[model samples]
Target chain A: MGQTNNDERTPTLLDDMFSVANKRDQAALARLFDHFVPRIRAFCLTAQPGSNLMADDIAQEVLIRIWNKAHTYNPESASLNTWVFTIARNARIDYLRKNGRYQTGIDPDFLWADDEDENADPFREAQQKRDQDTIRASLKQLPSDQRQVLAKVYLEGKTHKETSEELNIPLGTIKSRVRLALNKLTVIIRR
Target chain B: MIRYHPSIELLTEYSSGSLSLAKAVAVSAHLEHCKECRTQAHKLELVGAELFSDPAIPTSDQQLNQLKTNLLSKITNGEIESSFDKYGQAAPSVRMSKLQSGRPLSSESKYQIPKSLRQLIPSFYDDLKWMSLSPAVKIATLSNEKDGTQVALTRIKAGAFIPSHTHTGDEFTLVLEGAFSDESGVYKKGDFISRDARHKHKPVVTKDAECICLTVTEAPIEFTGWFTRLLNPILRKHHPSTS
Candidate 1:
């Protein structure tokens, strides 16, 4: 039933939804809730796994922010999707910072699924493809070893101890390598 | 002093909610004064959305509705107030009482700088040596105020030139009253300007009014020419900013 690709349709739908959401329109906000809550949950699960945070809780936080800050959204400065995701990301970070026990372990599954089947849900497929593209383009500038470590440590949700065991390196070395990797990744992502 | 770049990546992390608390507090203070970094942070937030999209989205509609109910109740009940207050968002305007508590005993109304900047100054204000630049521009040595730091209050006579000088250390100004302008921008009452070592500029007050500002300087001002050097001693010895 969807004609245009998600990159085009998702943003337009979100923009309308956001504009209505900005006006405090309940239905528009509901539509937005339907669309974004799941996206936030899935992303949080991938970005942070087994940290004991419920995806539903994070999704709720993201949605509440969407409602509260809807009026502050300026399309001239940021796209609708960017605005929404930024809200979600901030909600997650705030939650982790307050809780202090939330671990930011990256999942290895994120790396191995690049070549996975298209038949498995096109929306999820497209979203993963886009994130992979972003991670690859940004991380491509980093040294391979650093990228490898970050992908596993941050994106793959692996612990320093587990990564050290898997990579056949000492735990301290793994920590330093991951730190260096994050620094490099930060520079790239910022650029 | 580290440059307050508010780099896109840092902003992205901040907007995405992953930044550490201490660093976030520092960055929030910087954001208050820096327009360029704020814009950059907003842009990075856009980029972050594309970075987090997922294939098979989780968290269902019912759950989101339930969460919405809880959050609405929480907001109505003031749970969000504490979180907002922590980031200095609850109150952007500084209160007189709050300002007084931040500063040491000053007979005049206590000029409250932000907590981070206050830490840069020593507890004592009377220890700094005073110097003059012009009848209106006076500099004080803040060594006693805090580690070789200096404070000055420049009084720009109506239509006077503040003579060109290069900065060797950090310079801070809070316009207590009046107004002045340089190449970078115009500063009026309560507007603060912070110049790094690289900044070189001269300010001129308008003909209608005198400009009086409270300044905290971390380094010496390097006079640019022979004439300025000649005037330096007179200006330095006769500063009107003595406490």
Candidate 2:
């Protein structure tokens, strides 16, 4: 795996964020914002059809939430992305609904990643760095065709039908690509 | 053990954050029980996060650094957004305290309700005003802000059949207590069945005890049987209130 300092730092970043956030550490909060903001902004832009301005606003709100709701995050029920994105997706839906801009309908996509159910690690300060690196490496390893389909479907907020029409591929092909991509991801992640 | 689960397509939509609010709520409720699906959704979410971290998305360092400064200033100024206020709307938060009421009846002790489902309604025990549309069938509805996401706590007496109908859109049924089955298959507690327009069957509770379900419909059902059609008006009326 291509190791970046960001990747190395992120392994414990969530736990570090939680610990320092619970202490109301402003500097740690800033560090977290610097790290997660771009990715979250990207998420908002892709998951919802919003401008850079709107995505920034949403990212700001989501970061503020990470500070406020840090206590409520039970790391056992879900991983960092699951916990954070659940809040982000809900915030976006409610945000869009409040603005009367919720044209996309109630597509239930709360950002989640690997369920650690058999082992709910609420307090484990393990290799979140490795978790992220493995995930990124796994993603880097995916075939472009599979990766593109998965991206179009998940990130671009296109439904399978829409993805098929957009990519000019068969619906079955799209589904399989998604399955194969995820299945491979599961292997790499759990490895 | 969960015998039925939502399809990978639905799971994909769910983890990808493409499912609508109501359908998402239904799936969340199911995930509370089925650990396997929880793991699956979790994996898909990781996939989503990986895609989000793409270096190619082009969020500028200057723009991001500026945002970081702004965020810290906001926090330092004590403008930190509460989870309640993050969405920027004065939406009603579901009261969890209300759901902790006294037990409803025989089934209350029999099955563990998912916190996701429990948090949605005030009291699954007492708040469930199961209105009997017939002798053995009863349903109490909760309103959703979005249309067609009819959230209802439906109870069918042992050996009774749910309304025989064809779905106009997707329908999510999470069995809360006892067991029910149709031509498709048998569904017990924690078994989540997502049926689309192509699916048409009457769920019958063959277990000795009544079966309770948390159901979310993407659209109103078009009942096939003349008997169930009598519920068309009543059902239509209930849909408006159940959000």
Point to the candidate with the largest lDDT. 2
Off by over 4 Å in 2: A4-25, A48-50, A66-87, A101-118, A121-134, A161-171, A187-191, B56-60, B64-66, B83-113, B129-131, B144-147, B226-230, B233-243
Model 2: per-residue lDDT, tens digit, B61-158?
A: 67577767777788667766554352323122333333345433553543555555544553444456678878988887754445446777788889
**Model 1, span A105-149: residue lDDT tens:** 211111111111222455644544454344435555767776566
Write down the TM-score of every candidate.
Answer: 0.45, 0.78
Relative to the unseen true structure, what is the C-alpha lDDT of residue B119 in candidate 2, on a scale of 0 to 100? 41
| Model 2 docking grade | acceptable
lDDT of each: 0.52, 0.67
DockQ of each: 0.13, 0.35
Candidate number with greatest TM-score:
2
Residue A132's lDDT within candidate 1 is 35
How displaced is residue B167 in candidate 2, in Å?
A: 3.0
Q: After aligning candidate 2 to the native by TM-score, how far in Å is the CA of A53 from where it should be?
A: 4.0
**Candidate 1: regions farther than 4 A off:** A1-4, A15-19, A22-24, A51-54, A102-191, B1-16, B31-36, B55-94, B98-243
TM-score, first chain, each model: 0.51, 0.72
Tell me candidate 2's fraction of native contacts, as a decimal between 0 and 1: 0.37
